[model samples]
Target: MSAHVLIPTTSNLPAPRPAPDRSGTPTPGRPNRERGSSPHEGERLRPLSRGQVEDRRQELGDLYAEVSGGGPWAWNEARADFLRHLASDARRPGFSLLIAETTVLTGCAYGFPLIGAGPWRADFGGHVREGLLRRVAPGRLFVVSAIVVPPRVRRENQDRAWNLARRLQRRLLADDGAALGVTLVEARNDGIAETLRSWGWRSAGDGTLTAVPPGSCRVLVLTAGT
Candidate 1:
């Protein structure tokens, strides 16, 4: 969930994928983060409040479907329910959302604290197994839920793109002095993991999560690491 969406574009080249260390733990390193997606010309991003996201749920779902490369009606089939729940959670006290603006919703992401009793705590086996349960506390662990950046506005200006991401991350996290930031990505999407690592994140562990599709996920834990 580093809420980091490592968009794969034709311009991106293949790189080595990270593997678990000898101890079978997620290996941490400055893995090369491949670049592909960026904001197209005349496009900009703005931090959106939970209310804004709820108002634009349909748009977000459509963008998500397109970015996901899903078939027609994928929005209704796959994204509708997910967005509903995400928005609902955003309405809660501690949840947050981020949306990119380009005359419409170009990209978006949302997350919440992992501390206390919440959806994230539905299954804490992954945290317990990794000895991370003790670290979960309000203002401590932030769980990035989902990040979507449609292919429409990708690969525009490298610097601008970086700025957009930085802004979004900044908004998602207030300088609340959280000790660790956590995100879960599908096993197949290791590019996100690598990019998080490049951003001072490391492989914390791997586990099954009840996310959009309920599948295998690798936890990318952000800390003062390579």
Candidate 2:
């Protein structure tokens, strides 16, 4: 339902005309037009469902660890171990794992988002920066993870990873409406930054604007909003 109201700003006011519908019929039982309304009334966003909001809270928490001040080299070993754990549990219901050379298969799709944007947090772990975003909201609705092969591995996997990222963003948009965005972080030379620019991400600010070492991983940041 929709209604319009009018208010008088001056000391003296005149009468107002009634509002009409598309058919030109005056709406009956219309709201009082003299009352003043809050200036921010229309700016409030529609409240998301409780479950969806909780999931967003968790994702925000996970994002903190997605960006690490430390270098990726220091964290590769632990990341590998975590991937191994996820792979071991592939047979479980609501769970699967994949190992690929240059691309993330189905099981690794969820984690691809985090790998592109993560500082994943677990109770025992301080901050899990590298890797994919495996577990989703609502307790096992979706989960995924991956192993980033050595540089010797062909870059073909990157294409697969890109595809997975696109799918993930689409899913997130469907669920949360306009409440998400994606960011891409890459080595200054990986051309990842250029790719992000082409995709319509206005460069916000440089990350850790230091002399990035050769082969250092890049960071991509994506977000969605309602």
Q: Which candidate leads the pack in lDDT?
A: 1
- All candidates: CA RMSD (Å): 10.7, 23.3
- Cα deviation at 36, candidate 1, in Å, is 16
Tens digits of lDDT, candidate 2, 34-54: 133321122212223334434
Q: Give each model's whole-structure lDDT.
A: 0.53, 0.28
lDDT of 2 at 187: 40
What is the alpha-carbon lDDT of model 1 when measured against the actual structure? 0.53
TM-score list, all predictions? 0.59, 0.26
What clash count goes with each model? 5, 33
After superposition, candidate 1 runs with Cα above 4 Å error = 1-45, 128-137, 152-163, 175-177, 188-200, 205-216, 224-226
